[model samples]
Target: MQGNKIFIEERLNDGPGKMRCRINFRFYMLLLSAVYFTMLYIFHGNLQSETQKPDRNKLSMGVEMQNAFLKIQPPIDIKRKVLASHQEFVEITASRLHVQQVFTTSGAKRNDIEVENSIISTKRTSQMIQKTSECFLPAVTPNRTFQTIEPTFYVYSAYLDRRYNDRFVRIMALLSLNKGNRQLKVSCSFRNSSGSIVETTANFYELCENHGRMYGGFILSCPIPNSDVCHVNVSLQIKPVHRNYVVPETVQVRLPVTQLGWQEFPDQTSGQHENHGQHATFDMPYNFSICVPPLFGDIDVMRFVEFLELNRILGFQHFIFYVSTIKNPDMYKILDHYKKMGIVTIIEWALPSNIRSGQIWYNGQLSAHNDCLYRAMSLTQYLAIIDLDEFIVPHNGEITLTNLIPKLFDDKVCGLSFNSAFYDKKFSKSTSTSRLLTARHTGRSAIFSKVRTKVLIKPSKIFEVGIHHISKPAAEDFKVDKVDTSVAYLHHYRDCVPNYGMKCKDFVEDNTLLNTTSQLEDNISSVLKLVFKERKKQE
Candidate 1:
């Protein structure tokens, strides 16, 4: 013990000895850590290189470039234009509901065709929530078409205040001014039902592209007592930005409650709007007419042939198509054949040479759709606005639309809306068909993922037409009904990618997964059988 104590004392006396021992231990620990980390780093680097080499071919350069481009680009700021600070009522003339053709010196095209008996006239009464009447003429016509008196700067609004039963009014109008002329004073005045002039100024704001095709507008919002305004006058009291004009045009348009979307209206007439009782030869020939907008893009002709045959089997009597300037020749050849048979009516939508491409309010198709609706009102009891790829499938066992609709629909219903179900090309199933052409086209899927909506309505009730929904507001008596998917819905086939092949990736093994009798496959089969038999006879 005494010798150990002496050794300890010696160690304590040597201060550098203990310090050196501690320094050696720390150096050893650091060296071990460095070696461990180096080994891990080398292992990770080699593994990563091996994994990346295999993935290099799969990586998309185009996608990377697109992402980078999107990341660098600035976003467009959009705001809705406010047109009024106070509210006023305007009474729309029922007889003068027709669109007025405006003549422009620059554009060579003239809109001489007048769509008559489109407006349903009714006596103005205090209790009338929705009165069927004609409405606004589009300001932006085709380059060659006659220009209407309405300002080229167009405005429309659809707003409902949940707090009160009444809807808050908003107006969006576009102002056509010289380039760089940003600021201008605008006024809106209308004669109210109480025989007083209600006038207010509009505050304009530019909106974003997300608002869809309608151009940004100068908006007006204000609160007014519930009264009708007979006329609305919008004027720009500013000088030209560049051109020398006699005066800035004061754009005038009649104010109809229906135009303001204050009430719900029928989408089709009950054949009451025409003088049908007088003509003995005018037998009720058709039950329902399907009105489709002009065809765009290079659509497959076989698919369209399938569409017509199937619809006929489903009991749709008449068809109307607006033929745009560019259409597939094969598709048109078939359409021409149908037109000769008097089953199809083709309206040429001669777009102005100056109009920019893409979907917008200025697209002549809006007018075309409305025209078809009015024209078909007297021709058929019901009219449906649908797309080429859309199929209105009934959930009930009833075979035809006429049989199914009567059981589910009534006169009180302004529109029978069917939710849209999206069928992707990835899940298409193959059908066992001996014919090569039939086999090639029989792969569309019956199953779907998402549901958008399309409407079937009476023409007399529709005040305004929209892409998906009616623009007119709903009243107590008239409103849009969302039919249960179990009753019926639209099968909207969409492309998985741009021009994706018709074949589906995931084939549904169970043929009965759709659980409905109106399976598109079955419909297609029935139509093809009839068509093939007819062709054989002709040959």
Candidate 2:
């Protein structure tokens, strides 16, 4: 009994020690779990912090900022070198861009001179500025501070190409000056993968056609320092060099810098070398079409919109424009807006290096027109070659062009001709006029007294198209039909703005053209109102 009691005491002491050991083990495990969770939290935080670091790449400048940047210091001289005939050319991926100037007149005019030549104008003091509300004109005073109007620029089209040769770096730019002839100093830069720049600078000569309209084309055939050049930026800085009397302020026009390896192709016609192997397969061929060649001068936006809408209403499915340049930002925006809907196709119309300067018309317009014709032959059944200022309106009850085309078609007829009728701006007179949003014909009668002839042809039938007619005339191949005057006609609103001592006195008042008989008038107005309404709603 004594031995049994001693054993029980020893067992009780061992039990307390065992409980203590177990408690100590549990405390150690809990401490380890806390440390592991703390380590995990720290590691996760570090990873997140690393990911949240700001990017170190160079940022692109906004339009206004870039325009402002042009006014800085000694003009930036971007230089380039062309490849020799024998040297092996380096092929790098580059972006193609179409840069155009945005020309706008400031309300402040220089001395409010009405004459074409500023020097020849007679200065009259204390003139009463007549304000009228016929076209919502704003009230103005004869004495207002006038600042020199500087041109602004923007890139309209861009595309990526893998097979880019340094020899083919042709930069096409459209410049419109309010005053005297301006010269451009062009600078080009190529950026490699490592962010190093290789630059070249040169003076770009103004290329003009017989019509005296001028534009710029620079052939940059320079050797790029890096074989792996990924991007190219061209800056065409305008310094009114010719106008020695008036010091033109610096304005840097930024063309698009190509980003390498990014896959983006512009919506170009199939004939262009750039369109090779990347032609988008279409479900159905375009039926009726319109092709407008590259525009050089400042575009009237309101008129452009009306032109597109009226044609669309007339049932032209596809519209193509060989766009060299446009000065209006609103016009560019509207073109892009329509492009998204597949209603318009914009192609950059730069003269290829092989073509001589004389081969083009009105600053490479003829070549562009011919190219457009060739491009449309395979894609469209019929193409109406016209300008933004010209419209084909049906005189018959038939509203849509699609409806009227079949009635005029015959076994031998390859094209159709419409008598061109020109309208004077005085017929649609407006005192308070803003061309960007308001139609030129808002308050005018539908009177068009003068008439000339224009042509619309089957793309397959014609080999070449001229400014006024379709040609490459072969007795067996070419057959054109003239539409009856009572059926249809072409409406051309040519330049009617009078200069000093010149007046637009030829137009007469008539309502037969656009009032009750013409379907184009109602269709155009309704569509424009609807478009403006939708745009306002979105705004």
Candidate 1 residue lDDT tens string, 225-316: 46533235554555556554444465554332223221323332334323211221122234577888867778876678656655654656
Candidates' RMSD to native: 28.7, 19.4
lDDT of 2 by residue, 1-539 (tens): 47645654565567558766556556666887999999999999897665444332312334444444444522222211111110111011000000010001112121122112111110100010111111111111101111112332222211122222232222333343233555545566766556677677743323322243333221232345424332345555666646454644544333322221111122222342343334222212356779887765688666786677667656676688776557765666667655543446677654444334553346555445554554554346578988887778787877668778877865456678786655656565535343321244423223332234567876544534566665542124347888875788776666554443334555544333343223334434444454466678979
For candidate 1, the per-residue lDDT at 89 reads 18
State each model's CA lDDT, in order.
0.47, 0.47
The ten-residue window of minimal lDDT in model 1 covers 79-88
Deviation of model 2 at 124, angstroms: 64
- The candidate maximizing lDDT is 1
TM-score for all predictions?
A: 0.46, 0.42
